[model samples]
Target: MTLRGERQADFAYQAVYRYMINLINEVSTDTRVKLPSLRQLSQRLNVSISTIQYAYSLLEKEGRVYSVAKSGYYAWPLSGSPSTLPSGDLLERLYVAARRPGMVVLSADEPALLASLDATLLRLERELVRQHPRHLQSWSQPCGVWELRAALAARYTSSPSRCWHADDVYIGADLRGVLDILIEVLGLRGSTVIVESPCDWLILRLLQDAGVRIIELPWAPDGRLDLPALEGTLIEETVQLVLLSSAVSLPSGVAMQPFERLEVARLLEQYGCWLLENDTYSELGFQPQQAALRDLVNPDRLVVFSCFEKILGPEAPYGYLLSRHMSGELQRQFLLRSFRLSSIRQRAIARLYHSGQIDQHLNTLRQLLREQAGEMSQRLDHHLGDQVTYRMPSGGATFWLGSVHAVDMRQVFQHLLARQVVVAPGELFSLGGLHSQHVRLSHTFHGQPNLEIALAALGEALRQAQLG
Candidate 1:
């Protein structure tokens, strides 16, 4: 009668499946409950994905688990329980993405980097408060504290042609917010916007919500955004903006080459479109770093954005958008049209960074991150060569992997999940929400044996799927 031992020893997977089903009834407060991720439950039971897959299939057949399209499996969506739990599907996804003991975290590209604030910098922050007590008295004005923008403009522009005055810069909630304002002020509604394919999904989602028409440019293997594919679509609409992430490129950590950047500038000028360079990942890469877009581009058509949120963790709230693209009237319209940037949060985070606290920590963090990336790429190639192929990146925290098979990544995803490994499926990063046989994993989760186990489980899953 025990769920542990198979009542019918011939079916080892059946026991696990039934046990999961019964366990759901016992542990779940409501008759309708959510399911644990295949990965999390897989690790806890020391079981392979075959068992979990079989169990999940059986549960789905029996009406115990509900699958939601574009999301994941959940306990019956109508969980009758009065208690509100974080949606099981979301919790399971988070549990898999978050670093846990003996769990694989491949979904994000965060660095395995860390350091503490230096005493001097900490003292500077305190002194800023003591010396300028009145500065903090009011919510920082919309334009931002004048001194920080001056500092930010200096940091943002390295080329003489790109240098900006403090008044031209605006500190906003984040890149999405910045883009929204830029579009509104520029009267960009219904205008065509060009974006790189396999792009940052959140940004694409924003454009979609705004009813902005999107034209996707295919990316070449070297990570160059395909200028030719864009040319075909550019003529159809009044293409006003071309958005790009040139350094530490997301989803694929491929930075654009320097010469290509110069060409990008020239192309935009010819096309008579404005350029918005999103360099959020600029500082988080391995290479020496490329020149900022504005530094090399015609300033009248270029607006550059860079931020600390990605490089220093999302907790670091400060970032700046350098603008020389707007005219006197547009600048006034930008300022007058919208409430000032998220002024207070931007100033505080910038103050910590400006005080030299962030710089000191970054030096040590870079070294650790580089070493960890080496370890991750090595293991990925070793375990999943035939089924997966990846190129060790030259200098970014993330790398790309693809399978030649026509298989949906969801199988690999479920397989990894049973092993507690979570990676962002490539389909989610693709244009049109199309699923692909690829995924992106970050090396920042290195230095842990769980990562190793997860990779091995992935191999087994790939093999099993291939055979079937």
Candidate 2:
């Protein structure tokens, strides 16, 4: 089926699902409610019977409803009111508060290396503009600067499985923009996607905004991918895409082993699922580069989305999407809606990458991050020892912390916010509201003296909540 047709069909199923949920909610909780029949609902809702069936099947999988042979689907009795998922409203508030002047933002996800690279990037940007004045005379090519695309494509060409070319690379303003284009061009709306539990908040927000259903695959306590759970989910759910950081998972900061990547690749191939590999944090791994999942998954089934923001700093916010199978139509749709990135910045980054300066910068950045991670872990142990639990990050910038005792992280967030400290409550990470007692803290601001004060305050707030 065409992408647009699949999207429309999924939308129909979602409409029917929501309608059923509303209907089920209206009935008494003490008794079971027989749902409208597929034929009846199809006629009533002006949708095909197959759409209704698809909706019912999803509801059955979710345990919202059940079916008996020769009988219509029926709503299961409610145990209590359905729990509300964390809204973007709270996330927005936290983000805004985090950026307030003088606020101690332990919730930051951006790398601290950005500040150190300003002078170098500025110099490079100026040099590019001076040497390439003609770039200003014309609009950037629809696919972005050819040099940039070529440079990016060259990185993946070494993998025999991924014979990527410049045409296969599409650059956008940033990672989020690239993702938005992918969602639109791929017609991911109303489709189901599997994401890591405690996934990137931006990713979760974008998926939710696109009207996509998200299934979160949580990490095992030992910080490994729960392969069995992932396999079970793939078996049970009609998941269209799986989005994850194959090298280093966010929030948790756990790097996947080669075997784990191989297993995930195997499952994705077996289930015929598209993989959106977020390689944004791959360079931050403490150990040597692990095997790439791209080498394991079919090239056509994998789309790599990465950006220069973490490495080159937010000043050069450019992201590229790499896939061996980008169709002409998909490229056309992307060009029509996507913003053109700065030609000067693209050239500058391309120069940086080709000059091998990026590798040198990465080596320095990785060491800084490692030191910061250790410092953050030590501080956490000092202030909140035994009060909160967290896995010391293997890579990436943040720590996923769980309160040892029952405590509402949202409440902690609000409490800390009043004191000019901002924290990302774990509720923002999942659709199921499963991480209410957890919070994601970043080591980005480890060098700041106020970070220690913020951790102390956080420790106090968590202790109070535990006592209450």
Candidate 3:
């Protein structure tokens, strides 16, 4: 065959392989099920029989399927694929497991609290109440308390290309609420959006619930953004939005360099699509200097979503949406649907920012997180060694780990849960049943006494899963 023909054949085989995997994930139960025969699959996919055979052979080699003497291929028993579960259900199960007495949770993505702000917050809150006694009875503006919005706006005004003002900011209690409003205001229901694979599961759930069509673009083997695939999708599809983290992507923790962000900005601009940049982990990046896509993308086309929860703990349930070019109608709709946050808390946070305490806290928090990540990496090397493989994250609180050999991570999760440890299976981060051999372990519990024990338990669980 010619080189071009070989390439085409390879593409065809890959398509069949992916299709078969999805099909098996959707249909497989506790029992092994027969897959479509080679001839039938070839006819259905409009590919040559040899291509289907090759695909099946590869799956068999990967232990995802097996062949009978003459009956044909059969899918391996999935034993209840976790990816098939609803996102809410899976989350609830994990939450319940984490709440068990004496449970060591390595699955939670929430950052650890490095310092207390009780005294500072109390002082600010008291001052606010004392200064304006009558203001307590009035509700804050729907957009947010003016002082907090202004304080937040001041931080982003450094970009000379874009003028950011208080009006460009909208504050909410959490990222979920902010995202919900954006989805509604932008009229994104049923529209196509591109997201990174192995992304934050909560965001995936939100997009799914919003009735939006999601096309997942995967990272390259070298842990960089797959620019070619992204551009090709932009060329072939009418994507309304591209949602991604510019720094420290969740689960994977791989960050895009400045050059990559520039290329991404260029593609989004060329395609005339909106960029919903998730900057939740940008501040936590280990790099001293981080470049934002906002600097490269047109301000009119970019909307940045960020939250303080990762840095300030759940007690501070504050998140803000920043966009200078939202249409008046869209902004009006957002305000109409949004509820007001606590005026006193917002003022207190603004005070924290004004006093530069927030900056100090962030600096300390980043240093601690960096140290914890390094210690976790060293422990993983000491404990799991060659049994698992992972990339040390550039920043962020979690580690994405893949088993060195084929091992069902769902079973590993269960095994660890039984031993009073909780872990997040890779299925939680994907929809297509990929990454079944991977798991996401957070470093939030790094300083706890049980951390080493939890790691040992995890190693044992992987061993058992592989042996089974």
TM-score of each: 0.71, 0.79, 0.78
lDDT of 1 by residue, 1-468 (tens): 343343322133456776777776666544444567766666666554434544665565454664443354566433332232234443244332343333456676545233333343345545555665533445334445666677677676665655777877776534555666666666667778888767876677667767788877756666676766666666666788988875656666677788778888777777788887777766666768767665666678777766555555543334457776564644564455333332333445567657775666666677767777777767887887777866566555676777756665666776666666777777766566543766777777535767777778877876666523
Off by over 4 Å in 1: 1-103, 112-127, 134-136, 235-237, 325-360, 433-435, 465-468
- For residue 346, model 3's alpha carbon misses the true position, in angstroms, by 0.4
Could you report the Cα RMSD, in angstroms, for every candidate shown?
14.1, 14.2, 17.8
Model 2, which residues run further than 4 Å from truth? 1-88, 114-116, 135-137
Tell me the lDDT of candidate 1. 0.61
Candidate with best lDDT: 3
lDDT of 3: 0.76
Candidate 3, position 9, lDDT: 32
Whole-model Cα lDDT per candidate?
0.61, 0.75, 0.76
Q: Write the per-residue lDDT of candidate 2 for residues 34-127, one digit (tens) a residue.
A: 7789878877876655446656755654556665443567676554221211133676566445434566777878774433565677788777
Q: Please give the lDDT score at residue 310 for candidate 2.
A: 77
The lDDT-based order of candidates, best leading, equals 3, 2, 1
lDDT of candidate model 2 versus the reference: 0.75
lDDT of 3 by residue, 321-341 (tens): 998866585467655654535
TM-score of 1: 0.71
How many residue pairs clash in each candidate at the backbone level? 6, 0, 0
